[model samples]
Target chain A: MSTQSVAHDQPHASGGKYVQIAVILFVLTALEVALFEVSHEAGPTGFGALLASHFVVILLALSALKFWFVAMFYMHLKFDLKVLRYVFASSLLIAVVVISALFVLFTYNRTLWWATGVWK
Target chain B: MTAAVLDHDSADAHEEHPTSLRIDSRKLAIWTFIGSECLFFAALITTFVIYRNSHATGPGPKDVFEVPLVTAGTAVLLFSSFFVVMALNGAQEGNRKKLLLWLSLTVLCGCFFVGMQVYEFTGFMHKGMGYSTNLFATSFFTLTGFHGTHVAIGTLWLGTLLKDAYKGRIPPNKALNLEIAALYWHFVDVVWIIIFPVVYLMSLFAK
Candidate 1:
């Protein structure tokens, strides 16, 4: 809402930084795609197994890094007020909590349903 | 002379509204709105993740998603964020030509992304994977369709801002208007940055 006031009051990143960040993002994305393809062929040991087993973890990590770059630079969160940072961070924390709770509840429910011996 | 000085001081006082923290009210409001949006998108994404593999008889992500095409679309969206920022810089620097050029390019990228989604959706339907196909199809469409809607809305928002730039209404002091829209646009792109890998790439492998 007030990006207007801040844009005038604070100095923003130069054009070169924006382009550099963009390039870094492009490389990260390409790496993500490449890893996806490579993991499909990585047998079942050493680095391949690690990548195959932890595919989601690796993807999420890379994704988080990309998210940080965009949020910090493009969204100007790095230079904004502490209040704004707290607002966004708190919401994201709540979201993570909710998502984790859902996953746990669903897992527990599935086990209970499968264990209910009346049907068999 | 006293009267003229008093009038000048009154004008200066009118420009500076008293605030406890000196924070821009609009900036706080927008940040709050964006925070709420984070939760909204989180819930949707959680739903998609929950039902990601529950396709039953319908096609799954691996069968329908094309990584190469999505990568292209993602690139376009990322570049547009850069474009909008440059446009905002132009606006702040009072370079109308630079502002218009970058803003127009940003809008074009937005349109291109939406067009890619439209094409991808139609292709899915052609492959017999409609929204009601199963849980997987349903959640996938719901998540992505909502994202596409956001992009479409952003495109319209930027289009209006670009029109203003062309008409010479967006001066340096008023650059905040464009800045707010750019924030929203960048936020949209950020959401896709998460979605692309989670929904598309992660789903491709055997889980």
Candidate 2:
């Protein structure tokens, strides 16, 4: 789509604000890359549960930061129509449920992979 | 949320708020669509991350992804977002020439990004990594390839807009449309952020 597609609902003319947001996005990207480069050892048997907990926490934190950026800026959910937010939030909640269910089903049973002894 | 920003130039011209600006309308609808797409991409990312540790055969992420190239591409895509923002500013002020320039710049960046991607994919193939290589390969290709397709689509969209810029058919009133396109572009970039970490960086975690 071109600039002529939407009626200009330009944000506040404060150019600094966008520069600020862009800076934030750039920094976050760097941080994510850095996080991935940093690794930690987890449970072999002794600290297994503790390791899992730590990993889950770290992953959730990174994911949450990404979520906040997209929701706040790109989607304009931060300042614009609040009702529109429910759409994003609701869909995400549903997807999370479905994916989690898939993971649980895979872990708890064997129904999903009626493989050709090869691939799904 | 001032009356001024919402109602800037009340006397300039007024029409029904286009579907673009109306909440939970077109923009929101697209967002919901994107949300689902996020999960779609996320599924691919998660699969790649989980199975990466178990790669029975094929070029894994570390064997392929040239970080310098990808990082530069990332910067290109990010800066393109900025150009689109400038383009929007130009359009709001009714500056077609400047708008066209920035839009073209954004499109150029998209093309460059895609070019880098083609090269990257080719390089990966050269590393003996293909889609059928293994589960990790499947997920890697599906995930990044999916995003690559989006970039290609976005590039085409940008080209069409650029062509319209030349044809002088791009509506002057559709600043929101520029915004919509920019939003989608940025969202695509955002998806890469998630994937870069989950797929490219932690690729060693794949077995």
Candidate 3:
């Protein structure tokens, strides 16, 4: 985890952090583009397949990092109330459960989606 | 940056960073919206993944993609996230001029990305791949198309915000609402941060 910086007292960043973030974003984009180009071909050692798996993991991690930064800094979550954190966390957990259940049920051809669709 | 209002009032300075809520109402609301949006985006991503592998038109991810173009577009959108942070920076100090300037830059970045998207969509259409084409067609059009729509909306909203800033309504003192708006804008950019590689870049391998 990166250090938790204060959101007060000090002068705010004038996008001094931007160049670093842009560098990372560009690197990741290049890697994604490269991986996409290579995946369509059949390699001797299934390199494309192996690389695709790794690519997905890396992309997800990067995306999660983006989420954390925006939530912490841009959203000002870091300097806010602890109770508010709990509220958001609990809501997120419930939403994940509900969405996951729905996805699984629908993908599995469960009757729930049908019934739900009927109501819709 | 909404914390600026609390800056002058010494007693309020101890209150919190964003006075949008007595506590952290803005952060909480924004996160909850993000939580819901995850599913909204997930549906599109899932559809893309499911169909991406099965495009039968002989035209596929490799056939239509200009990797460099999509990659550059991704770069533009991701970099815009930084500009949003810049806006946050200005808001933090209650610097109205800086805030508006940075916000304007962010919206410009957004519009540029949207322009690239339109160009790419048309480029694909010219290749005999379009909304009416194949499995890849449906998935590609749906995912990227929704993302483009979002960028457009975000640009419009940010423009409205800049106008607000011009009228001095976004006074450095009360920056929470703008911060929340910036937060939402960042989330939109972050979503593209994921989608670019997942939907566009990864497809380069899709032969």
- Give the Cα error of residue B184 in candidate 3, in Å: 1.0
Q: Share of real contacts kept by model 3?
A: 0.38
Once model 1 is optimally superposed onto the true structure by TM-score, how far is the C-alpha of residue B46 displaced, in angstroms?
Answer: 0.9
Order of quality (TM-score): 1, 2, 3
Candidate 3 residues B67-142, lDDT tens each? 6787777777777777777776787677887888888888898889889988988888888887968988888898
- Expressed as tens digits, the lDDT of each residue in A1-120 for candidate 3 is 000122322333336655565566566556555665565453646787777657667666666666566555544456655554565556556655765676676667734555766767
TM-score of each: 0.89, 0.75, 0.74
Q: On residues A40-77, what C-alpha lDDT tens digit does candidate 1 reach at each position?
A: 77887878777888888888998999999988888888
- What lDDT tens digits, residue by residue, belong to model 1 across residues B38-109? 887888888888888998787988889999899999999989998999998899899999999999999999
- Off-target runs (Cα >4 Å) in candidate 2 are A1-13, A37-60, A108-120, B1-25, B205-207
Highest lDDT, which number?
1
Better of 1 and 2 by lDDT: 1
Error of 3 at B112 (Å): 0.9
Worst 10 residues of 1 chain B by lDDT: B1-10
Interface RMSD (C-alpha) of each candidate? 3.9, 5.4, 7.7
Model 2 has a clash total of 14
